[model samples]
Target: MIDQVRALFAKNTFLPCDVSTIADDADLYDAGLSSFGSVQLMLAIEETFDIELPETLLTRRTFASLENIAEALSGLVSKAA
Candidate 1:
């Protein structure tokens, strides 16, 4: 999931830095992830992970970092399980 997220960031021109080097806990927003880019990422994540994100998780806190993204995904995946 992290790999997919990194790839999404790498492919997005909005991300100002290398995706691979981003720390798992690093804030993507602070690293230059624009608000619109985050929405794009959310869509990518849904497609990649095969999970629909609930509206409750579509907030800054959930997308703040790679770790947060993973946590949000884990919740959704576990719920589906």
Candidate 2:
């Protein structure tokens, strides 16, 4: 799951650094993730995880970092299961 998130970032131009180099708690926004990039990332996440993100989870906080995204995906997948 984490790898998929990293892959999305790597394939996109939202991040300034390599996905592998980003710290788990690094601020993705500070890493140069623009609003457009966030949306793209969000879409990629939804597609890759096969989960529909709730409106409440669409905030920047949900995509703030690798750890956050993993937690969000874990929660969503568990709920579906």
State the C-alpha lDDT per candidate: 0.82, 0.84
Q: Estimate each model's TM-score.
A: 0.82, 0.86
Let me know the TM-score candidate 1 reaches against the reference structure.
0.82
lDDT of 1: 0.82
Off by over 4 Å in 2: none
51-78 in candidate 1: lDDT tens per residue?
A: 8898999999999998888778877877
Residue pairs in steric clash, candidate 2? none
lDDT of 1 at 73: 82
Q: Name the top lDDT candidate.
A: 2
Once model 2 is optimally superposed onto the true structure by TM-score, how far is the C-alpha of residue 27 displaced, in angstroms? 0.3
RMSD of 1: 1.8
Give per-residue CA lDDT, model 2, range 1-81, as digits (tens): 677677777777777678888888999899888898889888887887788899999999988998899888888988887
